[model samples]
Target: MILKTKITLALALMVSPVMSSFATTFTKEFERSDGIHKVKIDIYEESNADTKNSKITASEYVKDKKVWSLVDYVNKCPLDINMALIKDSFEIKKINGSFDAVLFSYTIGCVGGLDPVTVKYFAYENGMKHSLRGEERMVTPDGVIDDNVKPVPDANLKNNVLLFKYMTSNWNKASTVILE
Candidate 1:
């Protein structure tokens, strides 16, 4: 009985790390006011609870009512590596002259500067929320990691037009899109 107990304990110790599950949740709240529009933003982050993945969700509330929400998966890593959102990189900005268009960004993964950062542009028009642009970029030792979307030369919010520069990626010279 003593030998059998020792063997069982050894096996348990060997499998403990592989069977371990760590879970965590984090939340952040802020308010943004542009003119007469008041928006309350809450960012919720959850790490590998029972879902086996980390995710970040941004909920927008107007007049204490939930209006819109966005989510990004931070993904899961090996036992030695953990993935989570970089709270410091999360930001929301008014991109247009009107209060309709807004931009938000968040960085995911363990490495600070080496992780992929995502930027999303949203517009609320005619009492509805619409996604205008969403892209991710990261610079690593090898090269630049980015979505296929062309880089904007200038965020021309004055006229609500964006000029995309693609030459840097050896694509088209330029292209224009109406952000509004």
Candidate 2:
């Protein structure tokens, strides 16, 4: 029994690092520029041996400086680290006359097809960052229901406010929400 235990421990130590790397894989990186600011985006895929599902993460940087690291944001938001933002799903737009007042929008892909897509907005005003509110609506074959479902799709900026429009599951109806 002692010999068996020693062998098990030895094997576990050897496999742990390899398993960890497999659990979270760094996939790719891309860059986006809006004339003034340059954003670098990185994509990662996280999985677990205990579960069959995996999640994707998007990390953003500006001018080679980290602006919104998904890992850090997830930790601060207390969101599931595995629920990652989709790649190339972010946009930065000027909100008002002041360039400092900018709006950032991104989307998080769900694990299943039926799961509602999550779109998040961030406001940068006077060098401060704030998370705007979110809204959702349900779509049905018969009609659109304002079942308090958070809207999906990308976010748009109008008069310094963030807005989103999403269609129901069946694409039969559409709804819009203003995030303040």
Candidate 3:
């Protein structure tokens, strides 16, 4: 019995490292200015007792030197931002002449009995970040003309624009924003 127990303990120790290696993590890289400037997004899943949570971090490197990070930008937000609620999932909508447009969606707490998912548009250009505002729509549409439509990134530098669709406070209308 003593020998058997020792063998079982040894096997468990050997398998522990192999199992932990399967933890979820994802990374993506983008480059501009002929690969002189680079941006990397790293997503890491957190192990928690009650809920599954993940963090998305972005870093910018210029010629192998770290320049900026997403954390820095979030810290400067005007409101008391909850970094934990920011989803790990993000879309790199477009890479324009010297900018990369990114979309991050997060759920805002109930305000006036309405909880809305706000989609924010940000652009990284010339080693700086800028927020792109949605153009005011003249008339509100009746219903969702389309659902879950993915925007295609334009490769032409001349057409330096980022286009994406997002949901508004009302479920009936979906709005599209163009960032240039």
Candidate 4:
């Protein structure tokens, strides 16, 4: 409960501006051609996540059950860490139909997880945005961080992701992401 609350609070703080225009919410489902795979993603058209400016980087270490849950082949995973900007890849995938979401997957080849990742591409058919996670899904990337100490790789470590993302969860939610 605490962890979930923390995640929730942390997300609340990265607001740029409150948009009242897009209140409608919907879910879209997609299918894969490898024979059998159906993907369902909660979609909010014109979500506040789409409109915002962020210099803050938000990151979290992926480990233990958390990391394992994200990808099942956790044992052989090469990337010790992963991260993306709030509006970078994440938002672009939603805003533009240019590239399929399944193709943007960060990791590929690693196998055996709670769920096979199929989030790198998306295809719009039947009036719904649908994409399946290819073998190439990645949480972030394997990289080096020079904190001036023994540098240990960390996954899900987003940097300067947003302003409110730095503060404590309780404080973050109060930061309302603004467009300005």
* lDDT ranking, best first: 1, 3, 2, 4
Best by lDDT: 1
> Candidate 4: TM-score?
0.16
TM-score per candidate, chains pooled: 0.41, 0.41, 0.39, 0.16
lDDT of each: 0.40, 0.39, 0.40, 0.25
For residues 1-180, write the lDDT of model 4, one tens digit per residue: 999999887788664444432221222223333222222222212213323211111111112111000211212233221112112222212223332222111222222332222223222322233333222212224432222221111222122122113222222122112221
The residue-by-residue lDDT of candidate 3 on 1-180, one tens digit each, is 999999999998876643111122334466656575555655444332323334456666767887666642232222232222234434453544345554443322212321132333344445455443232121324433223533232233113333322222211222332222
For model 1, what is the alpha-carbon lDDT of residue 58? 55
Regions of model 2 farther than 4 Å from truth: 1-36, 52-89, 100-113, 125-127, 135-142, 149-180
Candidate 2 lDDT by residue in tens digits, 57-129: 3344455565544332221222233343323324454445345333334444433333344445544443345
In model 3, what is the error at residue 49, expressed in angstroms?
A: 2.3
Q: What's model 2's TM-score?
A: 0.41
Clashing pairs in model 3, backbone N/Cα/C closer than 3 A: none
lDDT, candidate 4, residue 163?
16
